[model samples]
Target: MTSTEPDARSSSTTSEGATSQPSGLPRVLSVTLTLAAVTITLLGLRQIGSFVGPVFLGLNLMLVAAPLFGWLVRIGMPRVVASISAVLAVYAFLVVFVLSLWWSISVLVNEIPAYASKFQELYLQLLDQLQAIGVSETMLTDQVASIDKQQIVGLATDLAKGIGDGVSIMAIVVTVLVFLSMDAIDIKRRIQLVRDAHPTVADALTRFGDGVRRYWVVTTVFGLIVAVIDVVALGIIGVPFALVWGVLSFVTNYVPNIGFVLGLVPPTLIALLDKGVASAIAVVVVYSVANFVVQAIIQPKYAGDAVGVTPTVSFLSLLLWAWVFGATGALLALPATLLLKAFLVDADPRGRWVNALIASRPGGGETPDPDVPEADEPDEDLVGVDGRADGENDSDDGSKPRG
Candidate 1:
């Protein structure tokens, strides 16, 4: 969803509008062939989705943690060793962290059925008091009963889904991280070979990898800081399942605009069940303020102008990716979209067309003028291709795009 445009036109070649080569038959045949290829690919993609999902998961893992690997290599370790070490450490930490979170949440969840009965009794008592105030207690009681049953069913479904996905997702993620991290060197080497044969496409792929890696690294750190803040704030408020909620904050914050609300809802509801409506309100307020402070204040200082995705584009990517890949897709939408944009968007003829369409300002896809030039080739500079162009990115932070 985000566009990380570079400052310079380094390895790129900017091609202006298409040459006038009118062959209506060739064009029609090309379109028909492309559609056929797409249909076949989509079917294959779905059939092997179980395997494909993990590979995508691993790619994102490598992306989110690439900086750490780069840093470790910088200090002393060989790139291979550092990459392996950093990847192992990250997965180890995530496994420990996620398990701890799941365990804590499960404990609170198990106690909820008991609390459900208590909640029903409290609601009845409150209804009787309301009846004393010239209210119709029977009507209020019936409404409360209906609401309680609905909530119970909802909670049950959510919990079951969570538990069902938790272990497999984590395992897939960890395995993918290992595979991607370990094979990254080989991938890079193979890409270099291809660059000799197809420099433009190879460069585009490289550029996209750099962008995706940087995007994930920046976002993950941003989310981690938010997660820490959530844990501290929720812990202070004595929210049950505070750790798991913190993990949710970390994950959901990546989902763009609506993700913030998704992170807030579960904990606020749990607070309502545990303490009172007042506690729930407090939880909501804390989350809103914390998110504002992290995203509006702190993150901008660090992220700078790295990602220029609009709210609409972000949400669209979320929906589209989720639809294509299912549950895992929803979780990995933004990162995957960024990756898709980076690798396939600029170099490939198809990518050029799609990017042109997406870059159109706030309107339906307008067939761009065929004469608009194509970019030459992709490189590190492609990371900042969408930015306000200067000679080069002079910031000490190397992540920024330079022309």
Candidate 2:
């Protein structure tokens, strides 16, 4: 009876403990709830997309200029002077970009009207060719008559007007940049405060800043090379507004994956309208060769390393952010994705598994590549303030807190 009493007591205790412990929601239910929350949050963000896009753009600009700001401060420049100089530098770039875009759009609007007679001639030639191939003239006329010079002119006018309207948005972005730059004067100290309480968050922010800076540096360098190549090729081909197309190419380089296509279309179309089909073909071939060799073959390796996301993720991020914030989102997709990944994946120990899915290389950057020979000592440029490689953890246990 005594032996049985202890067994009964143990069974009772086990049952009580089991009943007292909390049970997690079912996996399906948890996922559904999370998805619902995300949907709602996205909808809210979409409502304020105008404000969000400019603010985010400012933040990205600040990140790119941060190193310059730091260098100026280190070189004995006053904090206030350095901060203003950085802000002005960014603001100057923005002004030049806006003016260039305005000039390009205005020139396009002016030039498009001059092509009306040529467009009519081409239209007749196309119709005659279609008739030769047995397509009905009446059917072709009815189907294609809507596409005329006036419609093209109207489209160009609308585009120019849209650019004019964006001046307000640019003002907001400039305002944000100024404020963010001022705050950045003490950013390191602020980060230290954040590190004291939430080390993971601090690390995530730091990584995000570093990633954005590297991305911009790589992208801008490649973009300039591609743009110059495009301009020289177009000039040799007698394409009008080659300089404008060059600027467009540089700007569109920020958009991932399809950016080359976007930059290619305007020049090709202009070549077609101005020179001929042969000239258009030449333009396409040159752009393809130049952009493919540089952007596709070479840029991706550096970009993949800089951003640490696979091609698939970068493309998907372009689509998703484009949907969320419109055209501006497309421009800011990489940085925005980096921010999300830093906080949601890198900041959480359990979420590290997601890196395997999204990371550009094996082991989510945690493992060194077997193909590359190991360095006896880490390169000084690769080392972070914590005496570890930029993305490396301090401990080998994989338990060290990271973001």
Best by lDDT: 2
Clashes of 2: 0
Candidate 2 accuracy as lDDT = 0.75
The residue ranges of model 1 lying beyond 4 angstroms of the native Cα positions read 1-19, 22-40, 74-76, 103-121, 129-162, 221-248, 251-275, 285-311, 342-344, 349-353, 359-403
Model 1 Cα lDDT, one tens digit per residue, 1-403: 1333442232132322223445355767877887687667646766776567667776766655665665564465565787688688778767765665455457656767868876897687777788888778767667777786778989999889866765676678777777777665334345445654565666555545564665566777889888898888888888887888888888777554567886888788788888787888899998888889877566544342233234445557667767666666766665566555554454555435564444322122222232353343322232222111224232322333435
Worst 10 residues of 2 by lDDT: 378-387
The 0-to-1 C-alpha lDDT of every candidate, in the order given, reads: 0.62, 0.75
The residue ranges of model 2 lying beyond 4 angstroms of the native Cα positions read: 1-36, 105-165, 235-244, 255-262, 288-302, 362-403
Ten residues in sequence with the least summed lDDT for candidate 1: 380-389
The per-candidate count of clashes, in order, stands at 22, 0
Candidate 1, residue 288: the lDDT equals: 88
Candidate 1 TM-score over all chains jointly: 0.63
Give the local distance difference test score of model 1: 0.62
Over 220-269, each residue of candidate 2 has an lDDT whose tens digit, in order, gives 99999999999999999999989999998897776545668868988888
